[model samples]
Target: MRKKLASLMAVAAASTLALTACGSDSGAAAGPENGDKKELTVGVFAGWDEGLAVSHLWERILAKKGYDVTLTSADVAPVFSGISTGDFDMAMDVWLPETHATQAEKYGDKIVELGTWTENAKLTVAVNKDADIESLDELAGKADMFGNRIVGIDPGAGLTKAMNDRVIPQYGLEKMDFVTSSTPAMLTELKKATGAGDDILVTLWRPHWAYDAFDIKDLKDPKGTLGDAEHISTYGSLTFKEDFPTLAGWMKDFKIDDEHLFSLENAMFNGADTQEYAPIVDQWISENQEWVDSLTAAKK
Candidate 1:
């Protein structure tokens, strides 16, 4: 369940957020008042700061439908792997035709692939403003520009691999070095570099706290190495559907606009009060009853 991803919350916050989905599962263990099903855990990655909110929101929606849920956190790849093994229940932010395409190509039969849950996720290169670099090509012969070290998130993360394999090579950065660190570690480096106004270049992904917190800019990828801005979506083990039919169906049908998701994301990133976010999202769903009714389906 490890994939290094850029912009993931700290290990502690990430861990707590992961367990939130399981909160419903704990309630189920206590016994549901209406004889509803047991609780389950959903592993998460990407979808940045929105992950915890997404997990909690799903948990509430699942509970409303009479099922308990728990959310787990993992690097993007592990989230998919765990679901396939039934170690985790489901995930709703798998970016498709790019991020998890390999998982789909290899494990399509073992797991279930649902439709897009959220769209407009973007992966790219980012550097501190002090670095003054603007494109991957600029790093070709300028090793010192980035300390010759390309800081990356977790080793198993799909985008990191893609950046190392496809993106850098496409931009002719073979001489540069790639270093793997956890999301928090990389951020620590970014914080240090940016705070000191030093040169630092690293991977950047959208829907992240770094973009909101740091004055970093995504370096242009002239070769399309970052891939197109993608549709971030969902996937899970077959058991997720079977064990929590109603909730699973609702999540698959769930879709929130970027403004709504981003607002919650910003709240979580800065550790702001989220009491309002929940109600607003809930009301949006409640008022848009037809959309909720759509998610209120039991199967694909």
Candidate 2:
């Protein structure tokens, strides 16, 4: 009986030590001592359609469970790097089979490639309707009518690289330059041209407010440089799940559909305040609890 009691005590001691090892000062000081105070960081990009996405999905979810989180925007170049290193605990904007494939390759061992947060995301080449350009190939050499420019997002964005190296060449525009601007800058340029009834060609994506707000058409690409439609997803450091299994599992399971993404993107595209975004999205989650739970319920 004494030997068995001693074994039980030893097992208890080991479990306590394991908990201490998993948590830092902040993670240890609060309620549960295992992960009660464990804080997570959710990385975003200006590319994230809704400003509150990280807050709604990461921060609020953690808060609901009595933990804390910090939300920050990941740099276009360093996003993959950050998640690879656990600098940011989780990131949910990897638009893939296209957007982050290179980054995934670049950091294969360092990060965990979670499945899509939402599927059916798209990246498209758009032309103003009035410009009358029916195909991506036609834009070549029409500097005046097509503006001889492909308005792109950040230079570090993988889509920009793909377009500059592949799309431009496939379309045979060897001399034309792709303007590596941002989403806002490209939108401004497009809107300016629209106001003047001028020509503008741009790199466009779905789950964006632009589709709802502007009259633009996606040009056909015979070469398929943009690839087929893909999903925007979540990724994390190699240790993300090991660090927070429950939250990581939730991330793995949680998903948004086209309608959900479109509504949020449309709201932000119309200029919603950033700080108020979390509550708005949380409300959405509450309203769609059944559907959301269908996706987020613990898997067998």
Candidate 3:
């Protein structure tokens, strides 16, 4: 089953890339006749649901305004590289001051940050709600309770790097086994463990649907080893602002608080398939029409 699922995901990724290439070619042909540049390619991080939701939201919203928007999924490294090279016009979910510091530093001059839209973004080691432990400090002594393992997502992820470099050593958890896998795999394990009322510790982040879908709580990071809360920002190619000032301005003023983001993520990813999020986001926009209008209201 896992192999079949992996194959399906791989096919879907290939399809997305094809669509991106086609969209770019078609949009380029149409731009001159349209009297304005109305095409945008957004680079999205694979396995990141927040990026998926926001990318689809923008794709649908911009399409309404006659913009041809394509979402291309890639790993973090390539996404930043694409953005820097101007192959992608924007990236909507960049965790700042820590998670993406390396990428930002490397490509800082090549890209422009439009603005931060979500605050208090966090990375955490979370456990089932009924777990005995409330903090990271308590985990070392009770390692066996969680099978002496910390389930983690992509090894290339900044979260994974932080866990191995700081969280493990700082909390004396080096002895515990840290399992690395894809985000979907980790989530599958989380669901199985939680459904059976078993203790499970998994790397998680805020602004994610898992928090809304599961009964879990973050283990307190008293030592600050996991780092402080960060901000989620929108980044664009260097020419993005010049090419689409109005859209850039709209993105600059776009902000969603935790409540709205959680609800949006829940609506899109909690029970429904991620690929079907565009319609869900369209419905969400209707429900929050005023807020949607506010997001695109012309700057005075």
Q: Which has the greatest lDDT?
A: 3
Each model's lDDT comes to: 0.65, 0.62, 0.77
Residue-level lDDT of model 3, residues 1-300, one tens digit each, is 011011213323312521222343554444433333677888877666677777777776676666767788776777788889999888888888877888899999999999889887787889999999999999999999999999987776667878888999999998999998777788899999999999999998787788877899999999987678888889999999888877887789889876677777788876586475667888988987887777777667
Model 2, poorest ten-residue lDDT window?
Answer: 1-10
Go through the candidates in order and give the C-alpha RMSD of each one to the true structure.
Answer: 6.6, 13.1, 5.4
TM-score of 1: 0.63
Model 2: C-alpha RMSD to truth?
13.1
lDDT of 2: 0.62
Judge candidate 2 at residue 43 and give its lDDT: 67
Best by TM-score: 3
Give the poorly placed runs of model 3, Cα more than 4 Å off: 1-36, 271-276, 298-300
Error of 2 at 235 (Å): 2.1
lDDT tens readout by residue for model 1, 1-300: 112244343343234342223344555446444333566677867434556567666665665554555666656667667778988777777656665678777778878865566776777678986565777777876768788888888776666878777987788777788887766678789888888888888876775667656668888878887778777666777865666665555566778775556555555544444433455456545655665565555454
**Model 2 misplaced regions, further than 4 Å:** 1-38, 46-55, 76-82, 95-103, 119-122, 128-134, 138-164, 172-181, 192-200, 227-230, 273-276, 279-300
Better by TM-score, candidate 2 or 1: 2
Candidate 2 lDDT by residue in tens digits, 1-300:
000000111111111000112245353346333432276766655335542343354454455444656666444446577787777776777756655667778888888876566666666778788776788777775756765677876665556766876888888877776887566678788888877787788887665667666777888888888677777677888888777776666777777765665565565345665645556656766865676556535567
Question: What would the TM-scores of all predictions be?
Answer: 0.63, 0.66, 0.80
Runs of candidate 1 exceeding 4 Å displacement: 1-41, 45-53, 60-66, 72-89, 106-111, 129-131, 141-149, 155-157, 174-179, 236-249, 256-300
